[model samples]
Target: MEQQSLWEATANERKERQALQGEQHCDVVVIGGGFSGLSTAYHLQRKNCQTIILEKESVGFGASGRNGGEVLTGYIGSMELHAKKKGLEAARQMWQLSLDSIDLIEHIINTHQISCAFRRNGDFHAAYKPSHLDGMKREQEVMERDFDYKKIKVVEKQDLHSELNTPFYHGGRVDESSAHFHPLNYALGLAEAVEEMGGTIYEQSEALSYRKESGKVVVNTNKGRVIAKELVIVTNAYSGDFQKTIKKTIVPVESIMIATEPLSEELCQDLIKHDRAVSDTKNLLYYFRLTADHRLAFGGSGRSSSKRDQENLFNNLRAGMITVFPQLKNAQVDYRWGGKVGFTQEMLPYMGQLEDGSYYAFGFAGHGAAMSSMAGKLIAKNILHEGGGDNPLEKARLRPIPFHSQHAKAVGMMKFYMKFRDRIS
Candidate 1:
């Protein structure tokens, strides 16, 4: 399969659109033209709602453009976490939703005929330490019994090391229903599909302000404004000052990644028997996978919600990658990039209507890509009142931490605590 390099995959495949110049009118205004915004606008336009997507930068410029490209259901749901909030039965449905998100992503690729190296091989979550394996085991037991999720299977040290070609992993949990692909390509493809469906996309038209007048919300960009009956905030962590309420509601986490020069076919095949992405079990972990070109794109993105020193986040992440995949100690790093991910205190993705026609969907916890794309559809469904496609999560509320200080000290303290924990271990 011949394709452009992973970093540049979406370059040639993007659907270019003119930026918003002057005042414009659209039925719905979608902020942030990434996966969440693009998919939402695409689906909304398909429903014949005259829609316009307002992109802060180019489409796929944020996390949608930069992510581990790992599609898996082990992130399906946490029984422990869900049980604490919504109980066991609701958690079971949450598990199904995670699995459904995986299926929905693949379905979009097939139905839209998007050529983003879409594959259904599977994904592996490996253990960085012995304790991590226990967490994996707990995950396996509850998911299998509660949701009848048989797609997940465990691989012991011997089998995992052989398949992963990494000595640091103790074992791994494999999910058959998940896969990986070029994320930016997928996001750009979704935007293209939206245009094909007669939707208008306005790039570089950052939403700087919004005024809710009457039933219409006027979205003001630098050069233009859209008076939309409904508005969707799909910007995630990049929402910026367009909406102070949204900006204050969530925290942005910095994620870093790197791409390596192409490897020998034999070496690539030896590294991963099949074509699935792998992430380890660490608070800050290493995620990597083989591309269609036989090169390895490993993720070592460190997160900083509030601004902090980023002088050497890449170098630290690369060092972490070598620690996990020591075999790649000498691999030539080709591209290093970073982006932000929004997270809510609840750890569940915040999805709900802010008002009658205004929707908020961000905070996909730590996993977005496919899940964020799924969220876009949900936003469209709620706006269109097509309740069938709207699931139980349509009404999920935001649970903010009582004391989420933005001084950046909160994360710094967490980092200090983690370092101490590691030292103790």
Candidate 2:
């Protein structure tokens, strides 16, 4: 019951990689060392490209390491809504891409021989209110008719007890294509694969600035400068001011999680009979799943952002756990952690080159485990001129959020809206 991530605690010790030293050069320089960056570097290395990855901290130190590890299919927003707005054919392609993203994860795990306890146990989208079932029904129908997808099945309130031993949910949908895994281990495995393929990764080396000079992209870091013919930015929610324009196009929201001490096997079986990852239908959602060692990893968002207020945040999360399963009221909490997720106005991820010709991909909302990996591969394909097809996100215009300087205030307002919506709906 350590005060750290269960994945980090159990993962194998990572060997240190050297940081960038004065004035190095490569064919491509990637900024950030999370899933997106590591995946991109791995694929690029496979194509015989000389690539180098720069990380502000160790690999996977950002959301990639801290996530709940639910590798789910599809984007954050409603597929039905996307179909209506962007046409059925377009929506179907996007849906297929999401499924392909899941396939990509399995391929990486199998190909790289990664031992991250990858499991395709499926995912449950529980309805917080009865009205939410109607949308699930519509989504299922759309997936079947328009996309020819049939892995998802609607679970009635009566049948939900068999899938999950919870009285809080009215009904839900289960998709068998989704999965859970040790996210940190997966990222580390990719880092190892990248190095094995002759690519270099520099930890603790933050990219400070980048400029085009003499037909090359010169990126300055705290340790050294990297000159390359191409550059890729995969910072996601940790973008900070590194790329000012891209940062403005996304909103970083804090997502907090807490893990309980290992429950008895019988209790774990009773809590989630099918061992599926679960997420409720609320603007401020709660997602949970059982870890490999049988710990209940529960997480959600809260209003406060202060680190000093963690005790209150932990209490709030514990109350949420009890609300979902009162049997866990006496369970001892083990770990408490939080990370930021980037959300776009459309609630979908964006990928493409910037006005300066540098490639970039981000804004996956909270459904990034699969999407981020797919995005990295796609970005590399685009860079190599391998014809990865036209990415819809690339067509999206990067629009800055209004009053971007008041992000904290905006998040406060969003919390209020979510609470009101949860109450009325």
Candidate 3:
């Protein structure tokens, strides 16, 4: 079976951009052509900043296009824990920012008329165990009492049938503010918008290294170089050795996804009743949603980085899907793909200027679709002197993770521990 991304296979055709040639000068140079870079270029160009985007591959070839298409509107970790660590006031601000991220995506799609099958159908956080439902109840209460946010509704085990036809979950919580979309198409649309607004993008042009020269930053690629007043590194998981400091601060993990052949409309409705994206409460969570063509797109933690592991990942995802919805027992998987996700020590996203005087953002965990786009806008504001520095995310520093070279082994051990705990609990 061939491994590919459903998003890439279905995404609209985009005009090919030639690799950078000779030398070019711009007000800002954004590295990586994923959501963050494209978004930063779009926002900067709208403000008449001479911006150029350098992409190693075609646009959206990285995590931005290969993600699970979940436009979630909150933290992946516990909200109450976040409130306890950072004062309630700080937590409140972060919560609002999360909501604003989703809003920005909707605004961009509407403003640029992006045809990415965008939908605000919300999402469901399922309880893998009976005790998990109790935690969800507390989360709902905390959001209402402390954050003044009450959009979440908890479904009891008895009432869970209305949401999903699965006995694997005991209950779940629904967040009406969350959404889903065709991520690759969205990224392509932003690329087009950036060009329309006078920003130039070069495909197959990777930033090999960069250095500060005088007051400007000089980025070098194999074919050419860019000299700009400012540089933004949005490479995230693909930042391999390009910047040692930033690379040390991030742990890149792989995530695998599979898309099943299109099911009958009736079967799709039976599987995901309300057509909302669904994720389970587990250390290695199971997230799945219905595609526009009625196919089930399922994803989970990937075990290894080896290309030979693709078959293993596909089997794992298919088994997980069948466990949740036995009706798909014989469903044929049409596509299988994997992408890297950046995780920080804090397990939260961060954005700020590095010691090298370059702006950067990464460690979105799995929330890049919404958070990364917001990071782009914030980075643009920082460049334009628009008070973006006031945000909490901008104040945090990306500290290097100790023993960074052993990330794969460490992640494997952690996954083993988490899986054991999940089984016992």
Question: Number of clashes in every candidate structure?
Answer: 4, 0, 0
Off by over 4 Å in 3: 305-308, 404-425
lDDT of 1 by residue, 1-425 (tens): 01223556534455567789888888899898888898888888888998989987788887787777887663423465566577777677767777788888888889988877877888887777887667767877876777677777888887885568777778888878878888887887788888888888988888888888987889888888998889898888776777666666777766677777788887787777787888766656678888766778887546543334454676777787777667677889877667776766555577887644478888775578668887888888888887564365555444444445654623743464356335422
Q: Which residue pairs clash within candidate 2?
A: none
TM-score per model over all chains = 0.90, 0.95, 0.96
Candidate 3's TM-score: 0.96
Order of the predicted models by lDDT, top scorer first: 3, 2, 1
Give the candidate order by descending TM-score: 3, 2, 1
Q: Give a tens-digit lDDT track for model 3, residues 1-425.
A: 22579998898988889999999999999998999999999999999999999999889988999999999978756678788888888889889989999999999999999999998999999999889888889889999999999899999999999999998999999999999999999999999999999999999998999999999999999989999999999999888778888888777787889999999999999999998988888778899999998999999888564656667777877998899999999999898888888876676887888887799998888889889999899899999999544577774556677663656534854565365435433
| Model 1, residue pairs in steric clash | 252-305, 254-303, 254-304, 256-301
Candidate 3: residue pairs that collide? none
Candidate 1: list runs displaced more than 4 Å.
1-6, 74-77, 303-311, 355-357, 388-390, 394-425
lDDT of 2 by residue, 1-425 (tens): 11477677878679788888898889999999999999999999999999999999899988899889999988765777678878987887888888888899999999989988899989999998888887788889978887888999999999988888988998899999999998999999989999999999999899999999988999998878999999999999889778888888777777888999999999999998888888888778899999889999999985464655777877988999999999999999888877878776666888988888888888887789879999999899999998457566564357676654746535744665475445434
Worst 10 residues of 1 by lDDT: 1-10
